[model samples]
Target chain A: MAIKEGIRTGGRSARVQASVHAAVRELLKEQDRASLTVPQIAARAGVTPSTIYRRWGELAALLADVAVERVLPDVAPLDTGELRADLRAWTEQYLDEITSEPGRNLMRDVLSSACPGYCTNILRGQLQVILDRAQARGEALPDIERLLDLLVAPTVYRTLFAEAPPTLEQLYSLLDLALPGQDPATLCHCDHRRR
Target chain B: MAIKEGIRTGGRSARVQASVHAAVRELLKEQDRASLTVPQIAARAGVTPSTIYRRWGELAALLADVAVERVLPDVAPLDTGELRADLRAWTEQYLDEITSEPGRNLMRDVLSSACPGYCTNILRGQLQVILDRAQARGEALPDIERLLDLLVAPTVYRTLFAEAPPTLEQLYSLLDLALPGQDPATLCHCDHRRR
Candidate 1:
């Protein structure tokens, strides 16, 4: 994160930016996202509140920058040659990542911001990775964009609002419904059907 | 509301509860949900903070009661006797309700609370109405429980996080994807396919 932040603008300005980003991340580790304030962030970073205000204008903007620059890129889906396997594996990992204390906080911070096209853009890219690999193997995939509603939205909803996040079993159940006749058991060793 | 509260208990206690709920709803009309504080709520409700604290213990618990008793139940999905039309109409109405300032605040309040099973309980009941009607008409449906992911999640996600909520057009697009063989145009007069 420091390297990426520093690479954009070298020297003291870059150092300040890195520190601010670092401070945001560090504070997130110890506290809820809603509790974070600009003055607190500035104090943690050893920069004046004016510096943060001048650079990012608002907490939301700073959080958006952190998301685009640091967080979303790390959420890229991996290629495993098979679409179903890749999706199931990716979904599990994605859930694990997002439901973690820091991950949930960071995601909530990003989503709560008014950054137009950020969530869909990052999600589309991730889904595209899985889709492209599926299409390469001559599998007839549905419209990649349409799959977002089926694949991404539910898990996100449960994570944010429901008392507990959707279990892997529940996710597999959704996949079974979405891709009828595409047995999830064939894709992975997990016997979610028994559950 | 007073009548409903009074039925549960009676007299001054019921009046106090009614006043507090009314105050929360009224205050929500003018301000964003995140900005509301317990002291402000107490002042508006014409009650002491100690009374509120003693009764509800925290802002989240109080908000959860408001959601359960008032907001969520009002989101009942209607039965138009046509599954696709009913789903679309319900989704649109639900979207309108949730995205409204007061609706959004109440929903955010309920979600941010530690209330277990509240979201799914309400949403499941709503979705079940549409599903039961669809099945009764001899339309083969996917697993009823899993449908929430496809039907409800995307709209909630876009409403809370995205720059814009999902349009009726985008929703039809999703329905088209979910119910592959069923044309939304055939079910309703709206010609989404031409788009």
Candidate 2:
């Protein structure tokens, strides 16, 4: 997040940017994405929204960047030396944050107006970072993409769109099933017949 | 649905209520739940919003009723003696719809909101009708609630929030793995290693 924020050549210097980030986090904690308009954000940050507009491109993009940057830092790097354990830990992290009021509320807002293509980009971009980091040291590079989709799809549907929430145990179990031997490609096609 | 709509003095007129059902669905397709004003619906339906409001109370409640009534007719009766097959068949109906433009757009609209609880209510009420009907028929209903969540959650998360679309084959494989005729009570635990 610091890295991304530092990328901008901005009118709002370091002090102002810090204030803006603080205000964004405040709105996020409140889980009031709808109420966090540019003017409101400006008021919160003690600056004009023109300051916000200058720094971040648009309303959605600003929120999108903030959401990804704030949330992603906490979820990366789960190396337990065992794929199943690592996946389980990550799943728990993902589930806990997502199921909470803040997480669910933020996800609901993002998903409501999200474009399918943009969604794919953000997910692949974010999850890929985690996947690549997890598999960076390993020899047999497996495609976790399909398995990630399968493993997490149900939870997202249920949480964001369905009636129930997928429990932590379910998430761990799904990850275990998906990463039977640190291999999602093979696991995806595993003989999942009625046992 | 008819039973619920029967409330609010809309007595003994099935024929009149049918057009309202179609109008809600049509209106929903064109507008987000938030943007959908009663006047817009009335105009489209060739009736006044008052007429629509008089027929159905609050906008949310009216929309909710329409949602219940629209999908209820399409759900396959659980008479087919198999759980996996029945769910597969049930999910199969909307495979294309969920993946295609309209379904995908509507899904994105719903999830991008920051209010999970309200969204959950609408989804739960609608999906539960199907699940309740299936369970009522006496098929070995194991984790019917979670299973339904598991089925729809992943795709929605991926499509709406993550931006990835699941192919029918992907959905097929998820169902195969998720509801495999094992002790569904076990999977219902959703916890891999158990507490």
Candidate 3:
């Protein structure tokens, strides 16, 4: 209650939210989602339970925030003049992040909640930057939005459903097919491309 | 234990599994994942808790089976002579299924599990059938495996992450780009094609 009653000191609110968010993440690692209580999170974060309840309303809402901001990696855009190289680099990076434990957990938690759109914004923002770079280089890309969907959805699908995450070769293969002039023979093999 | 021991009769095992599985789904609908217990599922299914524990071992495993077999819809392969038309029909069908509540739940549950490859086989099997048909018809398709990813992944990604699932139009555009010679002006609009 003391923390919540305190005056807003220019981003101090953000600092408090960050600490609460970090506490939520740490608690999650050690306990199951069902067992987690707002009071417990509040205690762990050194804030009043009312603060969490007032800010997030429910545990799922708080988890959604953590998933988007902290759990999902911030993917920087890559811009090689060639679309093939740029695409492979970006896809691999994206894949690696999502396949990690925290990444997978965040994605799962986000999907389970009522609002999946929160994660969508994060995914779209990252992919849009990459596509924008390719477009600037005069690549005759497909519908930029659709191109992103094509590039990303299957990996998520495979990752969620399949026994293994698609190999880097598989990602490169998809890019080759999506973009013109990149021969599959050269693109599908990650090892071949590097050499 | 008695239930499991008494299941050697014809179709009895199936009936018991079905009842147990149905009970699991019903219980999930009423409670969050963390709140669910084997005894609750067993009681709802009219079986002993030990039967459930012996069969599934954990809630996640049971949910995984349900997700793979029942939650995710069966996507039949489309075989329209034109690749553009076939892709549009297939994509729309797939999108509608995955974006639904059951589809979304199944996906989230599966992703939460250690093994994601299970869904990959389902996705791959459906896509492979479509690709093989296209190949048989001699369509100048992109790399078959990559084509599957390009066609399916982005839709899954956008559906899971974005505010709106990829529209039929977006899917058509991606297909148009992937398969040579289909102009976006003509493709990418399902409404236009229907008319």
lDDT of each: 0.68, 0.57, 0.66
Winning model by TM-score = 1
Q: Which residues of candidate 3, in runs, are more than 4 Å off?
A: A1-10, A25-33, A43-50, A67-70, A73-90, A127-144, A173-195, B1-79, B112-115, B180-195
Worst 10 residues of 3 chain B by lDDT: B1-10
lDDT of 3 by residue, A111-152 (tens): 767665666556666666766777888776644454466556
The estimated TM-scores of all candidates read: 0.66, 0.59, 0.64
- Expressed as tens digits, the lDDT of each residue in A130-168 for candidate 1 is 887887888757555456666667777888777678888
* Candidate 2 residue lDDT tens string, A119-193: 344445545555665567673333566555645566666666554577777666556555434333322322332
Candidate scoring better on DockQ of 2 and 3 = 3
Instruction: Give the better candidate number (1 or 2) by lDDT.
Output: 1
Across residues B49-125, which tens digit of lDDT does each residue of candidate 3 receive? 87776776666777777666664555465678766677677778777878888777766776676545556556666
Q: Give the TM-score of candidate 3 (chain A).
A: 0.68
Residue A37 CA displacement from its true place in model 3, Å: 2.8
Model 1 achieves a DockQ score of 0.30
TM-score of 3: 0.64
Whose DockQ is greatest here?
3
Q: What's the CA error at residue B67 for candidate 1, in Å?
A: 5.2
DockQ of 3: 0.35
